[model samples]
Target: MASFSGFIRKSPDARLAVFLNAKGVHAPDDFNWQSEGRGTKLVNDINGLIAELPEGTQDRVKAELDHLASLATPQTMTAAEQVCTAQRIDLEGLQGIQDVLLMLAIDHPKTLERVAAQASLMQRTGGKNWSAFQFEDDGEPWALGDDIARAGFVTDAIALLNLPEHRKREADWYTSIRVHPITGEETEVLQATIYVEARAESELTFGPSEGLERQVFQRVLEVGIACNAKERIVEICANGGKKIRDQYASSFAKHFAPQSAPPVEAPRRDVLLNALLSNPSFPTEPADGIAKVQVSSLEFYSVGGGFARFEHLGDDETIYQFLERQFGAQSPIHSTGWTITGATLRIMQTPEDGTGLSVSDDNQCRFLTISGDRFNAAQHGRCC
Candidate 1:
């Protein structure tokens, strides 16, 4: 009967081509109105279809088609909302809307244009914050207005929530996002959120929280106590510098405790600390620079696992004093200078091969310590 390509290009609804294709005139999925020169005869077919539209629908169809045509060339994107009023449609959200629409208009031009027009109308009347995609409708789109658009909203919502991604990271935390339809504002205005689930296949992670994640894992014991959370809380970073704490602090605190669990004296060696310090880098670095030690993201990925423990944090005065004094000018052959920072000590030490002395949780005894700039290990057979 009619060519599918011509039907899509000119008809307010591609029903003509759709009908023909459904009747085996053409493959239903093959029509792309975007391509040029489907056939000269298709124009006559499209004109006939337009006559069947409910009048002004053609204007919406024309505008959308023309806009789609312009995408063949570079188009300036002004990230704004067109807010004149009922007198004219607001173009404020055009960029974001156009991005999705352009993709949809490729093959499903008529359907997408109708949705775009409906969305435009919805945005115009819904509220100042309504979005093109999430239109507050008159319930018609739900009743044959646009099932495709309605379904997109559902899929779009799932993608926006990052549900699957969150499930993958094994998040110990979670926050929600509700997008304001018109203005496109995402809920959880807080810049970043760290979600840690105790037993999920995915995690909501970002990059900004790397440093914070490190801090969280390193002092998880203290945080667990402070926040009063019982679940296996983990830290995640979505991107560079997203404040995951403030975003989900109340929940995080609630996840731990409604009220902070009063500050407790940090134990001699917290469990996490004990485990991490056992690693080579922890007990031997400058305490000042220790806070900024760079660890691989790999370590962050493993998180709370034995292998990823970082040793480049915290201060232990006794340990510092011992290393400083014992080694003194007569420390290990490779003397590692350490700085004392409150409770955390940073030291530099050569990797030990279990030779001179063995230090463990039980035998962390106190003793007089020596201090000096350099040490000759061969002469003094004293323990370091």
Candidate 2:
């Protein structure tokens, strides 16, 4: 038997070879440490050996293995092999560590181990809040909403959105709300928006592209219903629901031209509005009209050295519509080929609102009063 002290006395490579040989995995005469597939083979054989050992001995062996793995250079060990050896996650009989690594685009063993530890903690504590890991069916990687949230994993919305395989099939901007099974509280699983040229064109014709908003609202309603919070839902419908729906409808109608626009697959549903009206406790007559304007402003810069600012006095106009109106055919900005290099919309609301709408730290909107050409097209052999 290879004693722990004896193993420690050997060089790193020799330690690994001796450990494997002692565990009955005899090395062949031509067994070169640099051979292809050797790293994976070593990991698998070590994992198998650990599985057969007693728990205490397994821990001791894993500690020694981790020490040996730490000495591995890039030429000697792959990242996955190092992670498997160092972490001993295989002892838990869990899979999909590789998938998690691939999804996050993580290449270093230390980062992999750190994230894996967070995921393990999340799985232990998050209870039903954890979403079904989408990578593998049986062993779910902790990558989605509740898992990431509970783990306190520092990641952006875009990274979370791209983790699932069905990303391309979904709309660019949307929200996902998850209701806690026990607490019945609603949590925004993700609120992500990727503004691309195609998405912008589609939103310009139709309203905001129908995505997960309604579905998420419906989910909240269902949870409220289950909790016997009918009155709360009614209040939500009257206040938040009606306001959002009416705003969306107003924006859509203001921008949509019936004569030229293509037909939409389906109109946006007044989920919140319907919920308010359908409630038995609701008033028979129409509720008071929602206030028209909340006072918002838009500031933009042209590709050339031009700056413009506009205030939206009416609630019906979309930001796209506001931009189009400001930069329409007769406007000086229309002739300048104004390409939007960046944009941010900051919505300020009172803390009492509990809406939790705030701008991301990285995407904070800044007003640049004085500007220059964003890019020099002539330098790239193009006309400005």
Candidate 3:
């Protein structure tokens, strides 16, 4: 047997031939390392040799194999193709050398000399069935591909790799609520949730018409599953998936129909208050005497001013009466002349609590001193 040190000193090709011959596989007279099936055969022979070696000698053998696998040459594309072939054949069985080869193909400056070869290798190796890869962290294999894609690599390969598996899988359907931004009203949304076998589920909502909705959901689901783009999937669902629907318009054209316009948002406090006022049970008349009143909306400005719009009150109601009814009878607004235009009602003022309230010229908006427990309490009360 050739000494292991002599084996380490041999050129990569010579070492590969020797390794193969030791496993009863013959190297032809003009053995080509780049020949089809040669790289996988070489890798398998090397793995067998490592298994037969003593535990202490295994690491050195692996290191030498790593060097051989990642050896850079003017024929970078040929080398990359061989590595990809070997990895595709024995990714999990190769004792981390396969990952080393992949990283070298992707990250090494010398191997990146051929951009076309790099891209080709990425597509070939990355496009292998995604389920066959094992992620080290949480076992979500697609996440590994996503990390590669996020590093500015092509995602089409990842998409291609995951497509077949997704096609054969069944999706779970569930109802999700989408809340109106202005009204806080919730609408039930239907979502199709699909996942890689034994992995996390990704959910995407359906679109407008039944037929088109199916197409949109399927397209988004496929892409989302391919890329593991959970956040993007959620955004598309929220926005009605219009961009995606437009993408496959040819397929969806027959299913097209007019979608109902989204609810027009009430942009102003008065408009929202008017809608509340339309309710018969809502108070339209001012309280005959001091009584609790519900505040409809409050907006604060950074320029030391803001406004609170109530649902409705009798036209004859005075600012003092409104303040008393809204804040409570014992509130500081009850101080004499406090209701006067331009009057400032100071309350809870201290080194810590600097809260104060002042009437604006119109008495509709109030300038507020922003800090302190009182303001927070008032804001919290309205929110709750």
Candidate 4:
């Protein structure tokens, strides 16, 4: 083990890392694959690098390196522990499973240590919100707490996960490293989170199996001058720099130097409108075989916009026939009128004819009412 130094800086666009050490090596592609034996190798490699450092500095990093290696085993609370934690009775009075889980998770010794490490780094680097590169656990953002604390929000999230209909929920741990590209100096922090249904009860039956996601950040000293045109914001860098070396380079500079306003232009309303309407790409159409089918259910992964849109068909009719009738054989499906309000979808068959289906949304469509002669193929159904 060796002493690691410097502020951690993440690349704006890549998960790949570049160390500023003697070898300047990049971590193995599988550096984060904890269970697949890849993470073990990565840990070994780091240990080897640490060993090469002078004896005096080794004492500084041995423990931390060992801890990183320990994470090769995915972190999660056992069912008994989770249940117990959720049902715990404390000074707050009777707590719901969600309340217990949230408090326990936030106060998790490992999680608290990680959060503290991040806060220390932010303070050391003079990094502030939006200015510092954020580390994401999987796709979820992780951040330090504020003066009022982040407990309320974390509780709300756990409550959502513990909804009556949910079968299981899990929390997994990950880590991110920030290093000085020129010095191999570094700071690493653990980040833990659970993706929607990531470790459901069914998933845990097979033992620890969630995947680990990781990233390392390294800072490079580069200066950038920005020039903005109507369509492009070009960056000219020092030492003949032609492009932006890193997205956060400007922020890094602002931290150490007086900030200057770079040239900026607001687009005109006409330009903005044109950009929105021109060459718009509509969402992909449902698969050809997706029609006249009953929907069993929908699973939402995130609260924003919620559930992913997927249409599944029951075994009633061949998808071809449904599509052929819905869209005229010789022409594309042209919507004469469509209105989506609340949970109902009202669509007109054609401008000249009142023929279409009125679909209601639920866990599944409760009813799909057909109108006019458009879908007259089936006696009870309406199709042409």
Whichever of 1 and 3 has more TM-score, that candidate is: 3
What is the lDDT of every predicted structure here? 0.29, 0.31, 0.32, 0.29
Evaluated at residue 118, the lDDT of candidate 4 is 32
Q: Could you say which candidate leads in lDDT?
A: 3
- lDDT tens readout by residue for model 4, 159-186: 4334443434443334444332223334
> Whole-model lDDT, candidate 2?
0.31
Residue 215 of model 1: what lDDT? 22
lDDT of 2 by residue, 1-384 (tens): 223332222324444555456544455666565434445554554466566777667776566445433432321223333234434433233223323333222234444543333333222221322211111122222222343341222122223323333233211212223333223345432222221111111122222564433221111110000001111111001112333433322222223211222212121111111111111231222233211112133334454556555544333664445656766763432445442222222222233433332332212222222112121112111121
Rank ordering of all candidates by TM-score, starting from the highest:
3, 2, 1, 4
Q: After superposition, how far is residue 330 of candidate 4 from its true place, in Å?
A: 71
RMSD from true fold, candidate 2: 26.5
The candidate 1 region of ten consecutive residues with least summed lDDT is 219-228
- Model 2 ranges with Cα > 4 A deviation: 1-100, 103-107, 115-295, 299-309, 315-319, 328-384
TM-score of 2: 0.18
Pitting candidate 2 against candidate 3, the one with the higher lDDT is 3
What is the Cα-based lDDT of residue 281 in candidate 3? Answer: 32
- Candidate 1 per-residue C-alpha lDDT over 1-384 given as tens digits, one digit per residue, 9 for 90 to 100: 222333244433343344333323442264444344545655555445555655566555555445554432221121112111211333344334334344345544444433333333222322332211111222221111234432332333233334453432211111222233223444331111122232323334444745423222211110110111121222222221223223322233232223343222211210122222222253335533322221111111111222211122223434334444555653221223322111222222222343332233113222211222111222112223
Give the C-alpha miss distance for residue 113 in model 4, angstroms: 13
Worst 10 residues of 3 by lDDT: 263-272
